[model samples]
Target: MNMMSYAIVSVKNNSDKLNALLMGMKGVVGCDLFAVSYDDIYTVVSNVKGANLIADKINALTFAGVIDTLAQQFTLLPVRFGSLMGSADAIVKMLERNRHEILQNLLKVENKYEFGLKVFCDSGKLMEELRLKSGAGEKMHLKPSPEIKNSVYRDYLDKKLAEHRLEESMLAYVDAVITEIAGRLEHLGAVNNFKKMVSEALIIDAVFLLERDKKAELIQVVKDLQRQNAGLRFILTGPWPPYNFVDLDIK
Candidate 1:
């Protein structure tokens, strides 16, 4: 049987508590949950038939569900969903090999939670607004000077220039929004990761690692941002284990 690892948990002296909790839980494909410990940290795992490990939505959710349940009571670094090893001895060797990095990541996320925020926009409408504000719209439609009006090359250049300007304007707008988000989260001491222009409709996709006690403040802050950027839709989710904050190297 292959062992599927769900998370690396900081059990400290609560191994018994963790063991009892796992006794009531099931892992992917209804496998019994168990732990393989080294010192104070443990990797929660379960027996998985080599043939039963399929990468499908149901199995993925079940894997995540176990991690989520464990996170509620412990500070843990969620292992990638499909992590597997041949045996318990192999897992113990892994724990010994990566002890320093594992403990360091666990300490970093000890009392923090991860939150996700996505900002959606109407691309056409946003571009139009930018053009109007910057007077680019009027300039694009202006009649060319008599000397260049009939020159095909000049007309083509003008069109390309307008497109270039619009692209720059869009990038600047996205940067401004990201700046505001980072500024607001700064006071709360959040560690954030931002990706801009993920798609035409999804302008911003970001995640933050913040203290558990600051969840409420983060919600209000997001609400204020939504109000400020009425043209964009902001959707926020989480309070989950610090999924984005974990830095573990498993080879």
Candidate 2:
């Protein structure tokens, strides 16, 4: 059976506790969990036929649970799900080659928690509200008058231009909200990433890595942001391992 890896962790002097935790926890499909180490780093792994691993919700959640359990006591770089190799010796050699990148990644996530913030809004309602606020429905001077120009092509261009302008206005509104969020979280020394307009209703998908001690403050910030942006819905989730923050290439 091949070894399916879960996460690369900084175990250091905590091997016993790591082992004890693994003993009580379950890996994918009732398989036993163990660690393969190089220097102070360890990769949590389980034995299973590589072909047997399926892409399903159950397996994904099980893999995340293992990383979640380990993150409680140690700083770690979460390995991608379904990462497998031939044997423990193969894993060890892989670790040896990638040791520098792994340690650097571990250090980046040490003593931190990753938090997610999603801002949602009714797209139609929000755009209308912003239009009313900005007087955007007012006629623009840039549009060529059909009576003066007498061209069907110009009318079509005008319609497309109006649509483009409305989309930009919507994005501008979202950016304003994101700016305020960054300002508030600035003092907490969080590193943040953002994606805008993920769906019709979801305005923003954001994640940040903050010092672990700032959970209370982070909650308060989200609460205050929710209160401030009455038109938009803000949902915050996590104290999770740095899943989104890991950036490394195994050599």
Candidate 3:
């Protein structure tokens, strides 16, 4: 059976506590969970046939549940769902090889939780609003100059120019929102990452990692942003494990 790794935990000197914790928990499909330790770190894992680790929803949830349970008791770097090593020895070697990176990442995420924010808008409505605000609407609606009014090439160029301006305006609007979010989160001392304009409707996808105690402030900040941007919808989720903040890649 291959070992399916769940999380790399910092147990420090309390390996026994981590061991006892794993002893009481079962992994996906009733696989008994165990820890492979090196120095002060432990990788929680379970044995399974390589062929049985399906990527279905049940398996995914179960895998996440294991990590969540462990996170409740320890500061861990949550491994991606399908991470596996050929054997316990390989896992040990992996832990050894990646020890420095592992410790650094674990320290970064220690006592922190990741929260996600998605900003959505009705693309047509938002675009129209932006065009109106930027006076692009009036320009697009204006009759062409007499010299170019009947020229198809000039008409096409004008249409393309208007579209380009619209696109730029939309990007600028998204960037402004991102800046405001970063500013608000800065005071909370949270680290944030943002993706702008994921789709026409989804304007912003952002994640923040902050101390566990800062969740309330984060939620309130999102609320203020939502109130201020009535044209867009904001959705905030999680005080979850730092899935997006982990910076380690195991060998």
Candidate 3: minimum summed lDDT over ten consecutive residues — where?
A: 136-145
* TM-scores for candidates 1 onward, in order: 0.94, 0.93, 0.93
Candidate 1's C-alpha runs over 4 A off are 136-150
Best by lDDT: 1
* Candidate 2 overall lDDT versus native: 0.88
Which sections of candidate 3 miss by over 4 Å? Answer: 136-150
Give one digit per residue, the lDDT tens place, for model 2 in 1-251: 89999999998888998999999988887789999898888899999986678878999999999999899888998889978899999999998998888888888999999999999998999887766665545465455765647567777876676677778889998898899999999999999999999997999999999999999999999999989888889999998899899998787
Compared with the true structure, the alpha-carbon lDDT of candidate 1 equals 0.92
lDDT score at residue 84, model 2, on the 0-100 scale: 87
Decoy 3 TM-score against native: 0.93
**Arranged by lDDT, best first:** 1, 3, 2
Q: Which one wins by TM-score: 1 or 2?
A: 1
Model 3 per-residue lDDT tens digits across residues 1-251: 78999999999789999889888988987899999987888999999887788989999999999999888888999998888889888888888899999999999999999999999999999888877897856576656777775688777977787788889999999999999999988999999999999999999999999999899999999999999989989999997899999886666
The CA lDDT of each predicted structure is 0.92, 0.88, 0.89
Per-residue lDDT for 21 in model 3? Answer: 89
Which pairs, if any, clash in model 1? none
lDDT, residue 52, candidate 1 = 96
| Candidate 2 backbone collisions, by pair | none
